[model samples]
Target: MLRVAIQVKELISSNVTSALDSMSSSAKMLHQLQREIEEAIIALEGERTKTERNLKRLKATLTQNEMREADWGDKAKAAMDHDREDLARQALMAREDCREAIASGKDDIAKAKADLKEIDEAVKELEAKREETREQAKAQSAADADKSGCSDAGASTAEKRLNRVSQMEKRTEFATEDTASARTNASVDREIDEMRRASTVDAELAALKGGAKKAPAKRARKKA
Candidate 1:
């Protein structure tokens, strides 16, 4: 009976370890996915900028072509007034070419605008999905931590103790980082003091070299 109990305990420990590992992998994957989504949104914004510039250029060209078509019609009318059929015919034909260019430019602009709209919608959807994923990952982590209960086939006492220790270690590591940050701030103040001394020394030397009046000496505090 003792041997059978030991075997069952070992099996439960193995299963618990496996489940914890799977949960860890899921958490890591979710974190990586969140980062990738942020990068994709940045890239989408860059593409949007390029597309906007292209749209602006297309619209500018379309405007120029439209003006040219109007000028061609006036030229054709003037030629006919001077009884020059050949010139009038050429002007009318050139106007058709301008019309074609304007049509093509408008079409390109329309497609680019549509692409921008679609990209905007995609960004919004992705941001929403990323937020949802963040919430889900948080809930899953909490649930995994909460699901520790009395099951005869569940994790053994040793396994639960190890998990608790692991969590405590993580919290302790965060505390260590806070201590390190405090040390960094103290060092920064020392560095600032050194900078002030160095600057005063440099200013004194510069004054002597330039034949300027010497700065007043700072009086040391007397012990009262």
Candidate 2:
């Protein structure tokens, strides 16, 4: 039973370490860890029950031994009353054996009680650690969700900006082309310059969107 308790302690420690290092797969890891802790608790409880039953049996045996010791003592007195020294000696020896047996039985009961205590302590520790791990998993899940939300919001903003730049570029092209036939050389040069400026703005917006698309991947790698 003590060995089982030690094994459970080690399992809990290992589970805690795993929980701490978990990231995207934390939910799955925590679920498995929870099952392990519960199994350990069940095992500890089984040991506790067996120890309790053994302790009860030991106490019952000790009680019977005490009664037998008393009976032997009475028999010895009766033999002395009948003037039989040999029978009295035999009765006294039987009572001594019962006394020895009672001492041994008491020791066994004490050891069983200690074993039960240790098992109970192990169960409590496992339960507490399980709860702590659950809390950690919840916090991790919330953090992951928050991060995903931010990433999505950034991507949405980037897409909207890109769309607005595309629309503006299209409008500028259509307007310039419509007025092309009526424009002089100077006017045409100004239109070309305007188109160049619009292209630069479009390129900048595209770069922003590209960076936004890569941001989530970078965060994921860092988390890993």
Q: What are the lDDT scores of the predictions, listed in order?
A: 0.59, 0.66
TM-score computed on alpha carbons, candidate 1: 0.51
What residue runs in model 1 are displaced by over 4 Å at the alpha carbon? Answer: 1-25, 141-224
Q: What lDDT is reached at residue 211 by model 2?
A: 55
Worst 10 residues of 1 by lDDT: 212-221
What lDDT does candidate 2 reach at residue 81? 56
Error of 2 at 120 (Å): 2.3
TM-score of each: 0.51, 0.56
Q: Which pairs of residues collide in model 1?
A: none
* Residue-by-residue lDDT tens digits, candidate 1, 1-224: 12222322332334223433453324434454455456556767777898899999999999999999999878866665555656766776677678778888989999899978876876776677568556666766666677654454333543553443233112223224577678869988878856764564355334333432222222223322
Q: What's model 1's lDDT at 186?
A: 99
lDDT tens digits, residue span 1-120, model 2: 645655575565554554556454344455556666777788888888888888889999999999999998788766655556567667766776787789889899888988887787
- Model 1: residue 162 alpha-carbon error in angstroms: 28
Leading candidate by TM-score? 2
The number of residue pairs in model 1 that clash at the backbone is 0
